[model samples]
Target chain A: MPELLSDAFEQVQRDVDAAFDAFLPVPQDTRARLVEAMRYAVIGGGKRVRPLLVCATAKLFGVDRDAAVAAGCAVEAIHAYSLIHDDLPCMDDDDLRHGKPTLHKVYDEATAVLAGDCLHALAFDILTMPGTSSDPFVRAELVATLARASGHEGMAGGQMMDIVSDEEEYDLRQVTRLQQLKTGALLAASVEMGAVLGKVPPEGRTHLRAYARDIGLAFQIADDLLDVEGDEAKAGKALRKDEGQGKQTFVTLMGRDKARAQAKMLVDQAGEHLASYGNDAQVLVELAHFVVKRDH
Target chain B: MPELLSDAFEQVQRDVDAAFDAFLPVPQDTRARLVEAMRYAVIGGGKRVRPLLVCATAKLFGVDRDAAVAAGCAVEAIHAYSLIHDDLPCMDDDDLRHGKPTLHKVYDEATAVLAGDCLHALAFDILTMPGTSSDPFVRAELVATLARASGHEGMAGGQMMDIVSDEEEYDLRQVTRLQQLKTGALLAASVEMGAVLGKVPPEGRTHLRAYARDIGLAFQIADDLLDVEGDEAKAGKALRKDEGQGKQTFVTLMGRDKARAQAKMLVDQAGEHLASYGNDAQVLVELAHFVVKRDH
Candidate 1:
């Protein structure tokens, strides 16, 4: 990994951890348990990939670092809440995430549900705060983008497709479409929101959009590969369950070698989209490479 | 019921149904089930009380009817989503709502969870749309207000209290604090957001806030009375569950007749807060009276 990208990831992790810690203070009341569950779900976990994407993209246009990190926190909150609900008994029924017991395993299922819900609301609340951006237009746009990406037409819709995948046989195209909505939408929103914070007009974001799209697909293909062959200890959660369920994925459809090649090709293409930004785009370029190459 | 208040409720129900129908369209994909569940939860159910409150308050300041309805739809989305999750097997464990099977009972638990999440996101999505407000500040404020009301410190926190009430012996004051967060927050937010849409400054909303607070408490007291004495067929849900669980409620803490008298007193107080608006506040006053008087 490049030093710049590694340092950026460390910075994002620190900032996001601090932000969530300050945002959620366990009240001295019966509601304390709910807040604790929410804190457990969000703090000190994951790679902070979404935050890194937001900061990296925002940096290109010289957006404020704090504002970028705030937006990243909002995106990560959505991601964290989705994971909580997805790990429930009715969904993946997983007991481990980030190498710890999933929320429902640690707390009851009811707490897990409420914590996820509270985190979901907290995402929009964070974006609307003046700390995110002084301009109301920027804040409103961020909320709109994140809301659209996380809702019926985006992550939740893709999750529905995944649930039905057990009973239905899907082709590569179908799987791709499903993953696109399930994962790609939020990834794209991260970059788009960064651009919005920088006041970049819609017409000026074609290359950034293309870059996000390429990396989003590459990221998923790599994930499918990881599930098929990665070490469970390093992955920090259950792997190989995708195959056990007989779910079709990029790895199952394209073979490991082809999927690896495709991801590498996509990463390369993603880097090409940032060519006009010169040296300022170096971190983003390295982040794309890391997306496919990371062990986790 | 007064004709003015009854007519307002009818108008709100029709407009909110139409708005949700237009906002959510089932796609020709596996996502159709999720969308269907979302539509089912939002349309053709409940009293549309929140929407009526929004339109009524917005009318006080002469805000645009279409824009007021759009904001009302956003609030209704949040209310509907909360009911879906609250009815889940892991939460209240109910099988019925609004005279129909709960989302989990009709579909599946995973579908219900996803549907609730999608609607939660859709609430913010609707608020950010051009149809809700032309001004960016209003849109941002709407998101902020709704998000705060629905999240950890408000509705979710109240729910956490309710869940623990089964094990804890809560006094009247504790129960009031719990209900204030659980039910009062969202109801108050309905009136606040309506005032926000009409550009009523926060200082100008003191009387309106008082009115919301009074009616919010009155509404819950009435709910408790209904649980003790109302018809299950009319309520469209299981009654007497509070006593079944040995939970302390307004009726249990304040006795049935005293609770009924208190609700009526609060309703009258709520009407007094609207006296400054004269005829314009007539429907709101009637709505407050209806809050404690309705059988369901």
Candidate 2:
């Protein structure tokens, strides 16, 4: 990784961890277990890619650092909650995530469910906090954006498509739609929310939106590639399960080499969309390349 | 029930149902099952107490009826989601809710979990929409209030306490605290968000807060009492489970007679707090009376 992009990732990880730690203090009561489970799930995992995306995008408009970090945390909270719920027995039933036992494996299923729920609410809670942004319009828009991205029409809806993927054979277009909703929506929202925090109006965000859209698809394609080829030890979760489940993916539909080429193509296109910002978007351009290249 | 409160409940039920029906239109794809589960959980069940609370409280400040109903729908979304999750096999493992088979029973566990999560996101989505409130501050505040009320320190935290209640012998104080977080927080938020939509400042909401607090406890006490004595057919769910699980409750701690008397006293006190609003608060006062007096 380029030093600038690597430094950005490291800084976001530290900031997001500190923010979640400060945000969730375990009570000295029976609720302690719930908070503990929530902390366990949120405090110390994931690539912090969403936060980095938010911070990087927000940096384009000179948005406040703390406010950007707070927004990033809100998006991460949604991401974390979804992972917890997705790993439940009734869902993906995964026992591993980020190289550790999943939340439900570490805690009971009920605790996992409640903790996921608490984290879901925490996302909105963080967004509406004055620390996120003093501007009510910004805060409201942030909430609306994240809510729509994570709700039925977006991430959750995509997840539903995934759940049914096992029972039905989906073509490339259907798979693209599903991945767009499931994974692409949140990624796009991360960029959009950063732009929102920067007070960039909807019309001024055309390039940023394009950049996000391209990277979102590139990221998912890369994920499909990684699932088929990456090491579980490095990925920190089970891989190659899609093939085992006979689920069609970017790799399956397009073949591994073609999918790899497509991911790279999308990433390059994503960087091109940021060309208007010139050198100011270097880190974003690097980040786009990293998305397709990342092994995990 | 008094005509005023009964009418309020009837109106809220119709309005909330209509709002949910409109808000959640099933898609024309794989996502349909998930939306179906969400609609099944939300559209046609429950007493709509939270919506009534929001509308009644908003009425005190002459807040727009449609906006209040939107806010009410937001709160109801949270309530419905909680019930859906609480019925999951790894949670309460219930097979029924609102006299219907639980969401997981009717669909599947995965659908129920996803539906619950989707509804959770829908709550914030609704609150931030233009129809909920045109003022950005109001929208932001509504999101914050409901998020806090439903998150770890509120409803989910209360649920955690309830999950552990079977093992721990809780006293009245502990039980009260648990109930306050679980049931009281969201109920209080209903009134608080209503006042928020009406642009009532925090300092100006003391009486309203007190009214919510009193009725919140009264409502729970009535629930515990009903759990012990009410028929399952009337209650629309499995009753007496608290006793079966050996959990501590108002009835278990205070005994049935004292619990009933205390509920009545709290209801009377709740009405007193709304006395300042006089005739305008009559519906709220009747609702308070109905809290302890209802059979279900």
lDDT for each residue of candidate 1 in A24-95, tens digit (9 for 90 to 100): 999988999999999999899999999999999999999999999999999999999999999999999999
The candidate 1 chain A region of ten consecutive residues with least summed lDDT is A228-237
> How well is each residue in B166-275 modelled by candidate 2, as lDDT tens digits?
88889999999999999999999999998998899999999999999999999999999988889999888999898789898999888988998999999889889888
Candidate 2 lDDT, A1-296, residue by residue in tens: 99998998899999999999999998999899999998998788888999989999999999999999999999999999999999998998999999999988888999999999999999999999998999999999999999999999999999999999999999999999999999999999999999999999999999999999899999999999999889999999999899999999999999988998898898889899998999999989999999988887
Residue pairs with clashing backbones, model 1: none
Clashing pairs in 2: none
Question: Highest lDDT: which candidate?
Answer: 1
TM-score against truth, every candidate: 0.99, 0.99
Give the deviation of candidate 1 from the true structure as CA RMSD.
0.8
| Cα lDDT, model 2, residue B265 | 91
Whole-model lDDT values for every prediction = 0.94, 0.93
